[model samples]
Target: METSSRFEAAIKKLYTAFHNNTLNPECCKQCAVGNILDNTDSWKYLSDDHGNLSLNYVGKVHQTLGRKFNGYSPLELLQIEATFLKACGFQIPLNHTNKRPENPTDNDILFNGLSATISLLCEIDNIPNVMDYQKLFKYKKTTFDYIVH
Candidate 1:
């Protein structure tokens, strides 16, 4: 079991879980990178010497999804993740305690920001069917490959 294979298996498991409606976003947020690292056995792989498993795994997922994942960095991936969540109707947490802004364009800005992130990730990770994220959020696809890798 190598790092790449492990990464593929983990992502596949995620894909299956997502399709089965059993993945808990809350749990994913809690463990984040650590969860992937710990689950390598289920997937069968290990991190490289540089602790670059997350980036490498994302790249592999991108390739497996038929998109290029080398163009962006983790920060960029974070941005995309934020946007994707927004497009899926998830609200962005506001730092200000004041009431939410009443502007309609606020949602548009949020969506564009997310879309840009997704597009960038798709380019870097070589993910296929960039539109699939939108579809997945909309529950249109039974299974979708949107991993940042």
Candidate 2:
């Protein structure tokens, strides 16, 4: 399956961040969209709150102007963050009172978050989920000749 260059770049960056232990939901510069944007916190301006899907005034302006950061609109960035946070067991619009995983950096939690984010990215690009490894299990049947020992 073919994927857009932008998607490929974003996924590569995300994969690196995940393995490097730099992906953090609580930090703007290390979050899902942040990593996609090369670990820049500038995407935070796209939304008023972390994990918020609604874009603020600045985000609206960018979206209206047809601006894309790392090939994603401001709205898409916000949605990606929201999806990551949700998959990581974080309550939307992250706050002190919201429920969240005890260890946000846990491998399992981060993996789930990354998986969901990748799915969303694929959805946005109308491509198959890259993380789906089920294809590797497909096997071809072949007739085998055997001799009893």
Candidate 3:
């Protein structure tokens, strides 16, 4: 499948899983990207030794993507994935946890969706270099600080 379509399918799968409360360890094993994200490598890349993304984090992730995959830079791949995940109601940190705050913001339908989407996107071996689409999710922030959008 093409990158866009593959990404869309992955986002849909995540959206479904997110609402269904299926983004747990059970599903991660079956999910290509989930397995990767659950491990140390993915976290270490993003977290690195600093324990958080640095000023050059985007560049670092872009470089990592280039090394791991044959096509598309990090921006090209994440732009769509990020947008779709936000639209599906995923907050970055909330996605990683099984529990959430009492009230759900526009964000934090949970990161389950974003995490799944990212994980699946990583599974794609070679994304096309062409930048066919560019979408950004402009979500307003509240007290919650861990949001990726």
Task: Please give me the total number of clashing residue pairs in predicted model 1.
Answer: 15
Please name the candidate that would achieve the greatest lDDT relative to the true structure: 2
lDDT agreement of model 2 with the native: 0.92
- The lDDT for every candidate, in the order shown, is 0.38, 0.92, 0.41
Compose the digit string of candidate 2's lDDT tens values, residues 25-134. 89999989889998889988888888888888999999999999989999888989999999999999998989999999999999999999999999999998877899
**Which regions in candidate 1 have their CA more than 4 angstroms from the true location?**
1-13, 30-73, 94-121, 127-149
Instruction: List, in order, the clash count of every candidate structure.
Output: 15, 0, 4
Writing each residue's lDDT as its tens digit, candidate 1 over 17-99 gives 44444433223231122222332222212122111224356455654565422233343334444444444344543224423
Candidate 1 minimal-lDDT segment of 10 residues:
42-51
Better of 1 and 2 by TM-score: 2
Pairs of residues at least 3 apart in sequence or in different chains that clash in candidate 3: 33-119, 94-111, 95-111, 95-112
Q: What's the residue-level lDDT of 13 in candidate 3?
A: 57
